[model samples]
Target: MNQPLTLEELKQVMAEADLLKTEADVEAALDKLAQEITARISESLPVVYGIMNGGLVMAGRLLTKLNFPLEQGYMHATRYRGETTGSTDLQWQAPPSVPMAGRTVLILDDIFDEGNTLAEVVKACHAQGAKEVLTAVLVNKVHDRKNTELKIDFIGMDVEDRYVFGCGMDYRGFWRNAAGIYAVKGL
Candidate 1:
């Protein structure tokens, strides 16, 4: 196992990290996502679930741009608790509290890396009798290691296959409130 970084060390790492997406870029992406979501399901009363912690930022930002009426909730499921890498098993601390039966659901998350967590969440939504399920992510990692055939309905940006943090993604449980997305150097 790797030694955990001290708070100072984490700050140093973040200071030297490369900025992948600027705040302006993130705003533009949210605007686009909002537009696409509106065009696709604005008339439908969809339950929007933010995959908690990481998805909070994206969901909140996107919610401001959406003009239609919608219900919002959160789901807390994670493969990485506070570690740099994910584990094989996903832990569901909390599921969506809203009623999803026979309703359209929109699940929003931070990044689509391996497609594991999102795939399972989508399945759970369907199991709950969601008539239609749509997914959106702030960043889509350009990788070849996807474990499912699921396609994200909306995307903010396509990032290189690197460990990223900020904009609600954490590095060792920090930096989620950073202005933009950043990739750790030499990770």
Candidate 2:
């Protein structure tokens, strides 16, 4: 509301968050993810599900980099729509269409905040009978591992909660367009 964060302040927080990834770094991560997806796409994978809204840009870009054929789908799940603290309860707008019975599924999200969302999503996938599920995320908020006791299978970039906007991440829904990524400055 109060001009959230100035460019300089944003830079400071990003430095504190240890988010030094440049624009090139983001692209390279996508490139690497594409290759990883391709390697995992062998043997008729069932579906690649993206946690909607936030995962849009990252998944869209990664989808282009896929060299092999892969089925793509979307599932809307909101954990922190209007709440400041991330939500532990996930609400799905729609269930995935592809059968999860003993099928391979790839789950993707924008950021790893508190691990609650990731953990619940993985649990849901398994509950639906997914034989094996691989989780992937673009930004890893390396603030406190003790708090976020969850592990990501394929990580694109390692950053703190400070440097966490752009390329799919957003700051109050404003800084998502930032090219190089940014960090929130104050409370």
Candidate 1 residue-wise lDDT, 9-118, digit = tens: 99898889999999999999999999999999999998999998899988988998989999999999877776767785667889788989999999999998888878
Candidate 2 segments exceeding 4 Å error: 1-19, 145-149
* Clash tally, candidates in order: 0, 0
Q: Give the TM-score of candidate 2.
A: 0.80
Model 1's alpha-carbon lDDT is 0.90
Best model per lDDT: 1
Off by over 4 Å in 1: 1-4, 79-90
Q: Worst ten-residue run, lDDT, model 2?
A: 11-20
Residue 8 CA displacement from its true place in model 2, Å: 15
Per-candidate local distance difference test: 0.90, 0.73
Candidate no. 1 TM-score: 0.92
